[model samples]
Target: MEMFGKTLCVTFDDLVGSGVMSKANYKRYVREEKFSFMQRGGNGRKVLIIYDKLPDKIRTEIDTKNPGAKDKIKKQQINPMDHRLKSDSKAVEFYKKYTPKISLDRQTEYVLNVKVLNAMVALEVSMRDAQGKCGFQNNKEIREKVIALCENLRERYRHTLPKARLMEKYAAYKKYGYAVLVNGNSGNQSARKVGPMEGRLLLKLKRSKFPVYTDMQIFEEFNRIVEERNARATREEDKLKPIASPQTVINYLYKTSIKLWWYGVVHGEIAFKNEFMPQFDTKLPDMPNTLWYGDGTKLNLYYKEYDKKQKRMVARTIDVYEVMDACTEVFLGYSFGAENFLTQYDAYRMALETWKVKPYEIVTDNQGGHKKPEAQYFFKRICHLHKTTIRTTASPKPSKALSDASRCR
Candidate 1:
């Protein structure tokens, strides 16, 4: 049978007994030099056939009769469990395809790391060869050396690498170069089960906000569509889609590409901007009183006050609009009321009256009252009336500063 491109021979007596050739015909062929053999050493008149020199028909017969020989040789040659061993070209392909794409510096570092590891393995193998203990056959001494080396490596790397496993890796490193040491899972997308058709259907279902589909709801709806299509299909190949789990649909929704596309559509545009948009650093003024921050918030504490119209004590929480020095975070002015433009106007008036000077800039959020044309007009006229230059208005652009200021207690 074939073993590493070499074939082992069958004996003449076995071939004759198997009825591949008659004993008389074998003798005649031998006499005519049609085939060749060698007399078995110290065995009188016994002969062995050279398999490579045999006719194709005889070789085929021998292989069919002794099918287990190739398997036995392969088992002896290499371990069946070592699946990570790959060809040289495959190792190079994996390294190039899986290396980190975050940046050039990171990719270079990763390649260097793999090269260093592979170099160490090469050094160890070279040392073993120099000591005449690198044989991988049924050699007890070499096996012991390899096992002891594996124990030290196991402690160093915290991995349970057996001798056979180490040798298998060494073999690959010798043949495949440093790329064999690179991890194969860096860009692996083999686990993603959702196909194109299913992805399209999922996105289509996701875009529907009438019922605002949950992951499970979307999966169920997808299943219903697939089933409907399959029921109407006349041929098996015409079936609409494959079966997918609810988690698969959920995973697709959470993917970066899908989230970027659908977040604004599902929630409001403002929410999507807050989550995915980048924020610029707001530089603070150098000195105190140069810049002031203003925002409105509800005070949690409730107070009971007498109401003349109701003839009873009414309990309610009040909204407080406050202004603070951006440099010192010191509160300068505040006004309490049911939230409205009047409270914001009163708060700015209080700040100017308390500070005795208007700030260079006052930043406030675009709340309902803050953006009112009347309120904007009031701000423009107030500081000019006070004989001090001022800037006070809501920013036209969306910003995290507004969201942060609105959370003020």
Candidate 2:
């Protein structure tokens, strides 16, 4: 019973050496637990800590015998650290990049992840520099000594070498590399809505010869298709499945995380190409305040105003009139108010107030309000006073009557 209690926690070698398991079964156990095993350094110095989970049967027995043995085993009880793992190449690389995962364990659970990683590195560095030129590979005694020293330090600074981290940090580091540390799952994500099959289905339906469907309706069709696939699935392992939420389909297929892709999906390929695909290689402005443009923009938010008839405040979005220096693309002045408040009168007022020396020329869109007899006369009088040229943008596809109306008005 004393012997059993003493050996309650066993390393891979301890179990195999004691005739409890064969080499083959122990390996299966290691893989099943996804143990983090670092290779012993090529030199006699530098031993890496190997953290493995206890087999469930062993764990249960320990807990049954000692009650709170689970918590004690996790802390200062001191498990095996540096027994070499097949000197596994892949496992070595995996250990280097993905030792500790991050999560709310750091926040809510208060897991000491940083201390563990730090202690691991510290033990390796101290072990990396041995005083004697004693051992390399063939000598088992010195290697065990180095590993023993590491486990001692781990026990001494138990907090620094926590057995388990709180969070999974579950990201595909193989595909995304180190970005998984910061970007998590969002990094290096595929542009396609999801994997190739769902993507192909989406593209097939969207770009088909038949009439196109709306995003919601198309996702419903996708759900039905997945259901059919699920129903006809011969084996559970062979099931070709899509995720449950329709929102995922929308996110993968139509979300504006990538605006250009969304535009291409909504508007035709040509429209997207014409609008955003063009490379904008351009030069700097020749000079500042050489010319100016004036326009009014409708602000997005609404303002509440007391209504005379209804005797209650009503919400209405306002417009903003602004003058800009065309050369520098600098906003010169702006004024915003109720919907009808920012008009040609406000535009002219802002332009005159903003300029220290009047711009050589001023331009505006050909809005009928800007072209009103009163407005044209007001601007014409203002330009004469300021000695500046005022011009309106040309109607690119002018109608005959519209052209005649413009000249007469």
Candidate 3:
């Protein structure tokens, strides 16, 4: 017999349309013979016999035309033990072994049903436990405990009971406060409310009765209050004002010790009384031509000087002496000097020449330059010849003349 060209094993429906296989005797033929059939438009609609195994004669014909055709066809033969075929066979085997065994005892059947129901409950409980202690909450110990607990239940009941059924029993027992599992859950407590003392303090502050103080000041006062309370045998039941320390009061008033010292000096006020303090408040003696205030002061020369090295340097010294009217603080006359006492006589002469009316009094300090023979000769001889009275005053304590000059400035 001649073989068809490259025969393909196709279902009858694939060739003659799907429903055509169900019509007439086609389904019967396929089921009975275990055969697949194909229809192709060849030699007036011939039916080709497509088999699981081809006849050896036709195989030989195919091999003659294509040398490797026989080996290819033999290799394509489906093996009973192949993985895909074996998987389907195993599934069928499992179903036969574990499918409902009918005609058993009704009580046995009911027990099995209860076990299955418990198994489902246990599974749900196990999942809930895991979710409750998930590592997503960042608690490693809790998650491990949960996993270990579930696994232990599985291992303990592995022989006669399902893991799910045991977990259900375990959870039910735990719900009744059995010691099956130790709970590691923790909770935070609510914070306590403020006490009466704090509330009272806040109320006082709100009412503006409490003095406004800086943090340091408040801390200092708190310490002082604590010390005072500790020293007392009986605690005072009244609200106490914060005691101020001498040092603290001084610091709060003047800010620094140096500032306090400066204030006392400039205002002529003493922290403690002195003899002169009382003397300053007393009256002074009255004497004509008995006292005079004289002073020497230096001035800045706004010029440069030249050195002996033939380099230019400005002269930088100018000094002045002044005589003043004691009663009126009037500037009598003044003289400038590069060297001291060079213009002392000139200063005196200027004073005499400029006085609108000359007084009998000529008073000055007892400096040797002022009382020198030349100075004395001029004052005594010239003033006596002109009938001008002269007298000298002794220097007072702390040189009131200099103090007065500084004050004038």
Candidate 4:
């Protein structure tokens, strides 16, 4: 029964709470009419009812019940200048270092411009006796009032100097004066090669992507496109695009947004799902020996052995079976040998002997040796004796479940 923002949406729960509709009727109504709604919140479970898109009857009903909806929405609306501002403790310590005596010869024009605008803002704030008071209420009012008064300052710098950004720059100005505004890469020739336009092209190319293009391949393609444009250009400005290094492409590719773009492409869909998709969080046993996890992998350590046919020493690794207590993640038993039913039995036996108590449940992967007749009989006998149930689950990620021994290997 409340309006929020420009969208004029309400929660389904709110509608039900206000007695405008029943949960069952809402579900059935949406289904029969094929109504469209927005989904949001964690796992997109929270449904939003858009008021404008609703049928006339429902919209009228909502309007009748929610009389103060417009007023409420206006009050709730976020002001552009309403921001929480705080002072850095280090600013006081840095105040003396940023005196008028500091040299400006090495500072870039852009830095000078930013500092000048910020200094004007600082002067206005001081004139109003608003110094040292960095609370959101005080600063928000100061910024809102001062921005209106500083017409020339706004015109010289960015016209749309956002209040939040202004507050940030103001803090920087207090800390390091003009020096903090100086662009670190302003004078570096090599760093300027992949400029903003080229960076945008790199991102665009990544979005319109190939499945198997490596970083180096993409880097070469990026330079090729730039070079091609440069070759066909008639004017000097059009031919000014510089050739960037592979490292620059690499750095751009690893940026947060770029990594998300290539997540499924580089690592496969399964890896993407494992990393980003919502998963069920299973409850663990409360005590030790209640549940156990068993898995096996080849040990990375190798021994040199003479191959009779090749008549040369070749390095080979042996399989290692391991059992871990589910609650504590402690390795209870392990056996190293060729992977088979015997090796698995040895590990399980070691665990049973050492722990002196049988686990109620044992989870393991569907390994070939586990299905062997001998292995089945042995497991069945143990289960019958200890009242244990063996369950098969997907193997865990190697990085998560690997042991100290695995790390050493």
Q: Comparing 1 and 3 by lDDT, which wins?
A: 1
The residue ranges of model 1 lying beyond 4 angstroms of the native Cα positions read 1-197, 204-228, 234-254, 261-275, 279-283, 297-312, 316-320, 381-409
Candidate 3, 118-187: lDDT as tens digits: 4434444554565454212323443344445445434543323334555555455445221111121211
Candidate 3 local distance difference test against the native: 0.41
User: What local lDDT does model 4 show for residue 374?
Assistant: 87
What TM-score against the true fold does each predicted structure earn?
0.37, 0.25, 0.23, 0.31
Q: lDDT per residue, candidate 2, 198-222, as tens digits?
A: 6556545544345677766766777
Count of backbone collisions within predicted model 2: 3
Clashing pairs in 3: 304-313, 304-314, 305-313, 305-314, 306-312, 306-313
RMSD versus native structure for model 2: 24.3
Report clashes for each candidate as comma-separated counts. 0, 3, 6, 0
lDDT measured at residue 7 in model 1 versus the true structure, 0 to 100: 34
lDDT of each: 0.60, 0.48, 0.41, 0.60
Q: Highest lDDT among the candidates is held by which one? A: 1
Ranking by TM-score: 1, 4, 2, 3
lDDT of 4 by residue, 262-328 (tens): 5665566777667665666779888987777777888989999999999999998888999898899
Q: Please provide, for model 1 over 32-136, each residue's C-alpha lDDT reduced to its tens digit, 9 standing for 90 to 100.
A: 886755334243534556677888987787678776764676565332222122224433444455423224443454454344334445445554564443122
Flag regions of model 4 displaced more than 4 Å.
Answer: 1-267, 274-276, 280-284, 300-302, 371-409
